[model samples]
Target: MFFNHWYKLVGMEALNLLESFIQSAETGSFSAAARRLGLTPAAVSKNVARLERHLGLRLFHRSTRRLTLTTGGEQFFTQVSDPYSALRDAFAGAAQDAGKPAGVLKVSMALAFGREYLVPLLGEFLALYPGIVPDWHFENRPTDLIRDGFDAAIGGGIELTEGVVARELAHTHVVAVASPAYMKGRPLPRHPSDLAAFDGIVRRSGATGRLRAWTLRNQVGEQAAAGHRARLIFDDPEAMAHAAMHGLGIALLPMPHAAPRLESGALMRLLPGWYADNGPISLYYPSRTLLPPRTRVFVEFVVDAFRTKGLARRFDGR
Candidate 1:
């Protein structure tokens, strides 16, 4: 009975050695597999040798030229590697969940969107998932997602780019708004060109100012006419919104930002018959098959939030 117990212990040690040997073979280097298993190269090599001795088969044909797995080793690796990999993934996932979801999640977003919409939303997201800590960057210029090491990004005018997956979180339309005070006696713009006659306030990169060339579509003409250069320019939509409220001029801004004022009748829409292009506000991330859990969770959250907020309504009729 003591010998039987001894044999069982031996068998378990042999199994451990076998697992180590398989990992070394699959990696094709003792040092590489050692790094993966958190063991020394000598230890991995020793276990692989013991495994080969027990099995009575050559596992690797070691040469100065290369570390080549023998035919038997290759067959074993092909059959077992997939299951072993799956097991490792499962274990890692379990470990991550055992504690808090621990990892740095980098995000890139538009300055205005980040400040106005996401700043508050992010606080809620963090409160809900205490394990996640977000490192967010906001910029006005176009960004390279991969070069910046961002786990994900949110922005307007999402271009089709390779190596990334993009999903539209919401639809946003550009509308011209002028203060009720400005429009009191002046005729509302019946056409796109009519905007040029009024002073226009613009927003870009958090600064409010005047802009040049406002693109407007003329339904009757069946074409778009680019408005003349702006005499006044500024950054920050809220500033522009406020300016329009104070009767500064006509401002083109996103629907959500302008919606409240429109509803309140503080601002009136220009060129109501000819609509501006309502594009997507999108969330994008790398297109790797195995997405990190945090990225997946955030994307799902944003999708659900937009749907719940009726984000699609702005572009429905357009």
Candidate 2:
């Protein structure tokens, strides 16, 4: 408020660009400021450059190790810092008070599971919060949540980096399933090793390109190798699931993709007692004490929808 009483602010860019200047001024390093801003060092440098161009003053002395504010930079920072913070706080307070999340929500999701299950929930999600605009990407691959600039991601076995957190949406359990037509003449496997006697619709690893073998685990904590002979092979689970449903052979498929078919009688679980527990499909986001309201509400909405819609249990491979 002191600065408010003393100074008239510049253009619109100043408000958005000032924070970058202030962060770099305080940290003395673009790398440090970038980390705080969840951006690349070059981006923070560019932001400060834009601010400098707007103000027609060189704000920082370029150095090999750290930045030092110019005399003019020092004066400007001192004048604007408190008012900038006050302006930020005012926006923050109003946003919290409104409790109406409105933003372009960016998200990454697994293709098969997202299509089979989550896509249906979009209408309801939008109906409840009409202001939110979802920009969704569906693909079968890993994403760097921060570098990729996604607000959140729905996935399984995503490597969590520092300053990121996960909330499990469902167990990413893989179960062996076969079309009923394929299983009609074949005897149901009595044990894990018995699967080897049957034809296998296996998955070739997308990351490694090697065949994915099943190491089955039972409820009693017993473990055994599946070693089913490969009758058909694919790198994508959706394709492998399609092959299995068409009676190609048994496939080791994650429950999210397999559950729909199993329920519809298009596919049936094989060796019911055994499954591979592949970590969990989770809602992942960058960890911040004060998460952006849009992202926060989205996380809450998905978790609540999963619980109420019985998707949690369905996707658990029970």
The most accurate candidate by lDDT is 2
Off-target runs (Cα >4 Å) in candidate 2 are 1-11, 15-49, 54-99
Q: Write the per-residue lDDT of candidate 1 for residues 151-258, one digit (tens) a residue.
A: 788887656578788998877667777887888788877766777788878654422333434455545646566354354466666667888888878888777677
Candidate 2 residues 1-318, lDDT tens each?
224423334655566578788878877888877755667899889988977765678899989998999998898888888777677545543553246877677889988788878789999988877878898889888987765557799988899997689998877688888999999988998887888888888889888889988788988899998876988888888898899888888888888888889999999998886888777778999886667777888999999988889998886754
Worst 10 residues of 1 by lDDT: 1-10
Candidate 1 local accuracy as lDDT?
0.69
TM-score of 1: 0.61
Residue 117 accuracy (lDDT) in model 1: 67
